[model samples]
Target: MSENYYELLKVSPRATVAEIVTAYHAARNAFSPDSIAVYSLFSAEDAQTELKKLEEAYFTLSNIDRRREYDRRLQQGTVPSAPASAPATAPSAPLAPVVRLVPTPAAPAAAPSPQPLPSTQPFPAPAFFPQPPYSVTPTAFPAAPSTPPMPPEGVTGAWMAQARERQGMTIEDVAQLTKIPARTIAAIETENLSTLPARVYLQGFLRNLARQYHMDATATIQTYLARIDSLKKGAA
Candidate 1:
């Protein structure tokens, strides 16, 4: 009987060029000198013969024109004549055994098969995990604010800073919300009066800042303005 290239490569007849290539590589590696497989079943000379068959199968099937012609010959059940220069070999040469490939429309033939160690040694047991101490119990602390509450003296720059921290609003965040420059907001937070904008602009900025903190805007504006005035007079 003529050789079946698909059977030799262990790839499906419908396999794509890539799958055929993968099967060819797998069959090659599976029979190499370093491979643990095939040593007992086949001699080195037999292995060489099998490799020749494998190369022949792969080359014939890999070519578009040759594959088409081979398929036509295959379907017609005719053995195509070998090249005139090619020396004839016995048709009864021993074939290499390989892992039978599952057909396509499923996982491809390139999937790795796991092989266990040749030795019979047992695996070590996993170590035990330490138990948590039962004497200590987890405790919950009251949710106190990280920053202290505003001073009783009223709307100092420190108070605005504390409120902003409590509100999780950075100076950049306040500037974004109020359309104020971030440096101005920093100046307001640090009580840097020389850098403070005109009172009209600062008043609008304070009202916007107060709205962000969800506080009474008018009270915040009046108290903060009064505090800054008192500080300025004290400085002079």
Candidate 2:
């Protein structure tokens, strides 16, 4: 089986962008060199290796275009998730031999014997373990209306997205121009309330976005914030 980035982050295939961000953060915390929990089970080097993979997966999945393309490839069985089977199998062969290859005759190898065993036991092979198949159905987006309606009096997140597109700006472009983090920008655009900043921060973000798009700041803030409140109330 190839490397599934979703499985790498321990998220389902259909995870939301916010969910992917959350999982990436959690994975980083777990695999960071300073993390003792992971160190207890795996070597600092091994943990770091995992961190690289995590970052790779995060960067790929965080971008909307990259993620959509990746998902398309995955659905078509064209994506290679991990290294080849040979290299993956190569690790096991060396691991058992390395224990025996230890120079007990040359040096004080007493420490090496007991040292590796304890850590090895705790390093559960999650990547190697069998996980139930997660079905990711292709998401079908609806076609836009043939006639573009007049812009509404109340602003919306969708309007911001539309305006950005009209200006031929990608999400990354907006992120760079506004100096907002890409993940945060994506969350705001998608209206993922759980992933959005607090109200105070969001107001500032909305203002920044408004200024960037030359929209009415006051109406942008009021409309978006009011929508947030309505959603929160509905959720409750």
Candidate 3:
């Protein structure tokens, strides 16, 4: 949590370098090959700029002397000094406080009332009310349990292996064709869909996988959607 490095990484001053690295990697990995519009927003030049900043921050913090100085300043709770050539402005004078006054009023005389004599009858104690005994029974309200999700038909690791072998396609080949990572494709084939990113990205990945396998992409997406719905229902 160094201010100089945090500023370089465009993160909060209290953020750790690990957090900075995580944010950087998240930005880098978010660029999907099939997303022309998203990729277009960050050109090679833009990427280089961000990479340069990240590298600079890492380099500075990784150095012993620089990091020691930064730590010293952080411990001292001081804002690091600027260059000697920086301009200085004159301090403004403090303003005087305004005063207000109000006219004084005369005090009023006290009024007195006659005290009442004590009564002979004793004060009555508060009466307690008693009720007849009644039976109190507890009621139970149980929630219905959620059902387990069903596995997809004709979709398994063995099935994927057979399909890939039949088509003469390797994991790498599928990745290159679809622009999805091999590990992600492996996760999909293994039906560990939660290992993937958000639902929208998963949908796109599934669509790409279907397209690469020459399967009906629409039907494939529908199947994935149904599986997700079932999973949610079961979890509920």
Candidate 4:
């Protein structure tokens, strides 16, 4: 299944880009050598090999153009088959003999004979302790303010800024959370197209940011592309 990118990433061929990203991250973590969950299940070399496959899958699927081409090839049923290999079976180790150890409770000691004793004087009265005076009053707190509504789809930059701020995220915070450079994020929010990368990379950045902000990634990308196209036509 090494040649099958979807299988390597553990995602269906119809998975969305966001789903593919999530699957890639999960697969990479599972095969990481430092991961405690699979530490004993895979050797370092084996982990590295699995990581390479995951990277290949992510790289191919993350790009829109490449994924489109890949999907086309898949529909044509033209994907090359992997070479067959003999099944590898490891010999199972023999089970060790089980030994059960049970401890026997010591026999009950002989009952001690009862001894008669004179009644002792009554114990002194216990002293009283003073308790601290404390009272808890229930206080009602004011409800949190509602966030402002995001701007319309055409105002991409304003929408992005409002969405980020509503989520209490700064440009630097978004950068760290999305792994996008702070400057690039700022450029995106400001609609400084010249400062941003090419359209392909811009699409990925916008999608990631939209996902992080809990916005509709598909809608965000579509609106962003439309805005760019409008600008290009106006300049032309």
Q: Go through the candidates in order and give each one's C-alpha lDDT.
A: 0.62, 0.65, 0.48, 0.62
lDDT tens readout by residue for model 2, 1-236: 33567877889878766577678878899888888778678777777777877766776675566678767766655553343112233343235434444664644555443333322212222353344232222232222233234267566667778866654457887786668888887877788888999999999988887765546778788988888788789989
Model 2: what TM-score? 0.41
Most accurate candidate by TM-score: 2
Q: List where candidate 3 sits over 4 angstroms from the true fold.
A: 1-161
lDDT of 3 by residue, 1-236 (tens): 11244555556645543454455455445533443544667666555545554544444443334455555554454433221111233223322331222532422232133222222222222121122111111111122122112235724444554445434457776676567888887877766646756778878987766644445666666776666667668877
For model 4, residues 113-143, the per-residue Cα lDDT tens digits are 4322223322222221122111111111122
Ranking by TM-score: 2, 4, 1, 3
Per-candidate TM-score against the hidden true structure = 0.36, 0.41, 0.32, 0.39
Q: Which stretches of candidate 2 lie above 4 Å from their native place?
A: 81-236
Candidate 2 collision pairs: 3-81, 3-82
- Candidate 3: residue pairs that collide: none
Off by over 4 Å in 4: 1-3, 83-189, 192-236
Shift of residue 98 alpha carbon in model 2, Å: 16
**Candidate 1 — which pairs collide?**
none
Evaluated at residue 142, the lDDT of candidate 1 is: 22
In terms of lDDT, the best-performing candidate is: 2
RMSD of 1: 31.7
